[model samples]
Target: MAKYVLRLFDDRIGVKAQGSLPAENRIIFIADGSATVSAGGGAATLAANSAFFSAAETTVTGGAEGAYVLRYELVSVPETEHGMLTGENIFSELLLNASMELEPGDGYLMRCDRVDLPPGGIAYTHTHQGGGIRCLLRGEFHVQTQGKEHVINPGEPWFEAGPDPVLAWAPDHKPGHFSRVMILPRALKGKSSISYVNAEDAGKPKLQRYTIFADEFIAI
Candidate 1:
């Protein structure tokens, strides 16, 4: 298998520039502003919450007012016949293989939102029922899944496997913010997207394993 490379890029442009993708495939998420990405005679204008895939060796040209992008260089993993059910990469702690199958004409539901936290804020442990990708827009965020942790900074991208338990925190020095694009099932149940691991964890101390933030909320 090939190794994956994750990178963060921030571009503030007054004029257009040339670009190219050298990895096998690169997934890009736009964090802010607007930009035009042209390749192979096709062009796409991207804004916040937008994402696109550029194949390897594609020559791209673009211009932007102000934009930050999170790029993931990914290699396709082998199929189940190869004997592996899950994998890990720089993008995520646990990349669990999707456990469900889609039927004919089935469609996926997408939920996009911006989640922000005050300085020294904490998000109680929780889980999402479907997979998603998140990109840090400002400050710093500490993401703990299961027991492993990863720090995500501005312009960086991270992944969520949906079923795994997760906790997010803001470092004491500054406020934190990020955007997410989640893929959920169309027939999903419930009025809320999140499933808190323990309702009791919500009232714990700030330094405890879980705690609630005063200004905590998600904008969908």
Candidate 2:
């Protein structure tokens, strides 16, 4: 099996700030304000709530109003530049770092998507075909997995190992939402990875919705 590390970073850039992201498979999400990202001989201006993917080294410049960016990347080794606050007006905080082991094969797919849960919605116990890192976007929820329970709040990140069963639910008073990036087998492209543990749950009502942002094939 080949080992990889999935990392999530929160970056704050000032109006005059600019920097380069290392050459790797990455998903860049614009959380607030805007940014201009150039990669692979192309440049695009991404507004808040939108995202894009890059497979090569990328240059990023904050917009006139600065920006709050979320970066998710896959690397062979864990990066040391975690909590860096540079005088150049760029600030970064590493939110999640998790290891993933995958069988060497043809190619893989990198998917970035958002999940929305209505108030009191519950995702029955289930497992996925691949692992991923999820960051809560709004409201609050609790996740039960591996005999442990965790309360996730906005801006917090968590990791889920694919084979381990997970059960998540949102509070009755408010809706919950989160965004995630997953590494999966190429065959799963445009497919859902979730599998309910109990066959009966498959017929239950599902109150969650999804929005796909980036789904690209990648070389291992």
Candidate 3:
């Protein structure tokens, strides 16, 4: 089995850091209070609804005041940075497994999934292939993809498909914690072409985010 080094504070408290990973991955939230990040311009305050993304580098401070965050690096099974499904690093608290699809298909297709976390349970820094749809059945969190973030509260559906992963993010988990994502395998189509039908320019990733596909409003 995979074991986490447990290097940082897993509970609610406070911490500081030097901005690192670029491309929107780190997520900060107001747990019981709030927090602020001191940057080149000024300090950005994070309250209950105010969250921060850590895709790029930026100086950050106290999660005190009520702000807290979970690096997808820390919350996963173990070595989630590598992005492998069959490994000991995957967390049971946030279980991710592959189940055979119910319909016609050759081999096996797997979807990214999440179980339940504790009070402060969170999932962060994930990637989705082109033409991917992420569904948050229960719970609340911001879905960060394509260099932007979308606050996906309970009963919301988000879709994205591109040559590269659109990017995936969410706050944390509580009761009935779960998430379901459907992605078409590259092997299915053979070639490595990933694109959205609504792309304004060929190979350009769209920025107009929506909670439903086309016109389908997913229910909570």
> How much is the lDDT of residue 141 in candidate 1?
93
Most accurate candidate by lDDT: 2
Tell me the number of clashing residue pairs for each predicted model.
0, 0, 19
The per-model lDDT (C-alpha) reads 0.53, 0.87, 0.35
Q: For residues 37-107, could you state the per-residue lDDT of candidate 3 as single tens digits?
A: 55335567666434443334444444445223322212223334432112122121212222211223322
lDDT of 1 by residue, 1-220 (tens): 1322222233332234444544333445555555566544667877755666554344333345544444433333332122111212111122222223322233434445567787898888989876666667789999999789999887667778788899889999977787665545565522346777898975665442211111111111
Candidate 3 weakest lDDT stretch, 10 residues: 211-220
TM-score of each: 0.55, 0.93, 0.28
Overlapping backbone residue pairs in candidate 3 total 19
Least well predicted 10-residue stretch by lDDT in candidate 1: 211-220
By descending lDDT, how would the candidates be arranged?
2, 1, 3
lDDT of 2: 0.87
Query: Which pairs of residues have clashing backbones in candidate 1?
Result: none
List ranges where model 2 is wrong by over 4 Å: 78-87, 104-106
Query: Which candidate leads in TM-score?
Result: 2
